[model samples]
Target: MKAGYVALVGRPNVGKSTLLNHLIGQKISITSRRPQTTRHRIHGIKTTEAGQAVFVDTPGIHASQKRAMNRYLNRTAGTALLDVDVIVWIVDRPVWLAEDDLVLERIQTSAAPVILVINKVDRLEDKAALLPFLESAQQRHPFAALIPASALRGHNLDALEHKIMELLPEGEPIFDQDQLTDRSLRFLAAEIIREKLIRSLGQEVPHALSVEIEQYQTEGKLTRIAALIWVEREGQKAIVIGQQGEVLKKVGERARQDLERLTEGKVFLQLWVKVKENWSDDERALRSLGYAE
Candidate 1:
């Protein structure tokens, strides 16, 4: 059987998380339209009769390393490139950007075969441009395979999976057949809350915020969870809380629904907004908030 690890590497908001969720047939990774919504490395495992693919969904690689969080994200994404069986480099647009060049530089250090995935083809206005773009991408790197796919609409993903399985080496499954991800329920719960926050708030506050699960307990068919939403400043906290607590209430409702679906049980979720004073830029604060390397 063919079984091994596959790293999904790309620039910010290039649909890496969307591709991973589609590949595994589950939403193990949180996705948002905003760039840098995904900050952690997550594993979405897919086991079929052919083999098991331990897909590593990483934070998008970007050029900015000015902040501590930015450096952490780049390190996390670069670390995933090592020792993986296959590298699926996803690019949303047909054309490559300077950030894509950044990703290329990192993956060049790895010996594993790379597959260049031109994602979001369904949205491409010039379908005729695909071939020339693919050819240009080929000249840049000796990719094992070049596939045009849409992770959102589930187009050409089957072909991508087939190629992945083919490239994987022969071995026993690394995880159980029924397993969908390596993350714990608590971790996923925090991510769901964070996703809701990212979707609910405007552009300025998403990256400044982080979610921490303060309490998680189960009783019968119900799971009670309390999550802390950490923002960088008091103004951000006020923005998250909103007028008359409307924003926080709405975020709580949305997060609870997803948590219920994930846990297969009723969820009692509580969300509170607090200030951590530029935690994203503070490496010590980041480690305390679960950004440890």
Candidate 2:
């Protein structure tokens, strides 16, 4: 059986996490439209009769125009591409790909073989417009395969999985076949809560907020989880909590539902909003959130 590391490198909102979830057949990572949704290297393992492929989903590559912490996210993403048996360069099929010129150039130089995965095929109403992309991928790079699949719809994922097996070098499985991700359950819980906030609260607030699971304890049929939602400003916290704390309540209820599903037990979730005063700018805060200092 073949086994090796494969990194998913691409721009923001291009379905990297979705594609990774599709490949692993599980939601090991959270996804959102906002850039930098994925800040750490999350490894999602795909096991089949043929072999095991560990897919590493990196944060989207973006020009660091926001802050030093933002640059750290990009650097963490870059680290994933440095060494791997294969690289899957995901690009949106219907949406414009020109914004990723710099990212594409970086992928082009990777020593590992690149596979152009054109995601969002299901979105393209006119399939005819994809020809240029289909043709150029093969001609432009040392691509092992140019696979078109709807990562969100689970189309052609079997083919992509098979291709990964074929390309993977002979080696031992990096992780257990039964295990889906390298992150702990606490980490998953935190990300899930963060995702709910991102979805309900919108981009401006979620980007400025960081989640921490201070207490996670099992109690009979219920799991008690206390999560801190850290924001940069008190005014932002006010918004997060919303009028009469309705917004934060909704966020907590939604997160509890998902966490229960993930943990297979009832959840007593407590959420708090606190202002860390520019946690994104402070090295200690960033480090506590798993971002590089």
Candidate 3:
């Protein structure tokens, strides 16, 4: 059996998380239109009759290291490239960007074979342009394979998966065949709350805020959860709560619905917004808030 780790690395908002979810046929990772939606390295395991692929979904590697959070994200993504059997580099568009160069530099150090995936090809207006773009990409690196796919529309993903499995080294499955992911229920609950907040709020607030589950308890068929939303400033907190607490209420309702579906039980969710004074940039604050490596 061909079983190994496949690191999905890319620039921000390039559909790496989307690709991982589609490959596993499950939503173990949260996705948003916002760049840097995935802040941690998550393992999504897919076991088939052929073998098992432990897909590592990582945060996007970007050029900006201006903020401590940005550096942390780059570090998180870069670390995922180590000792992997295969690396799948996903890009949204055909052409390369400056940020793509940043991702290229990090992956070049890896000894594993790299497969270039040009994602979002369904949105491309000129279908014929793909050939020239693929040729240009080949000149940049000796990719094991180049596949044009759309993670959103599920286009050409089977071919991509087939190629990945072929390149993986032969070994026994690293995780149990019945397992889908390597994250705890509490971690996923926090991610769900954070995803709801990101989808509901405007562009500015998503990056400045983080969700922490203060309490989680299960009683028979019901699960009670209390989550704290931390923002960098009071203004952000006010925006998250909204006028008459409507925003927080809506976020809670949406998050609870998803939590129920995930846990297969009724959820009692409580949400509160608080100011943490630039927690995203403070190293100590980040570690305390569960950003530790």
All models, RMSD in angstroms: 0.7, 1.6, 0.7
Model 2 per-residue lDDT tens digits across residues 137-198: 66667688988899999999888887888889997777887988888989999999999899
1-293: candidate 1 lDDT, tens digit per residue: 98999999999999999999998888999999999988888999999999999999999999998999999999999999989999999998698899999999998999999999999999999999999998999999999999999999999999999999999999999999999998999999999999999999997999999999999999998999999999988999999999999999999999999999998999999888889998999999999999965
Model 1: residue 176 alpha-carbon error in angstroms: 1.2
Question: CA lDDT of each candidate?
Answer: 0.93, 0.85, 0.94
Q: How far is candidate 2 from the true structure (C-alpha RMSD, Å)?
A: 1.6
Greater TM-score among 1 and 2 belongs to 1
Model 1 residue 13 lDDT score:
94
Candidate with the greatest lDDT versus the true structure = 3
Comparison by lDDT, 1 against 3, better one: 3
Q: Please identify model 1 stretches exceeding 4 Å from their true place.
A: none
Clashing pairs in 2: none
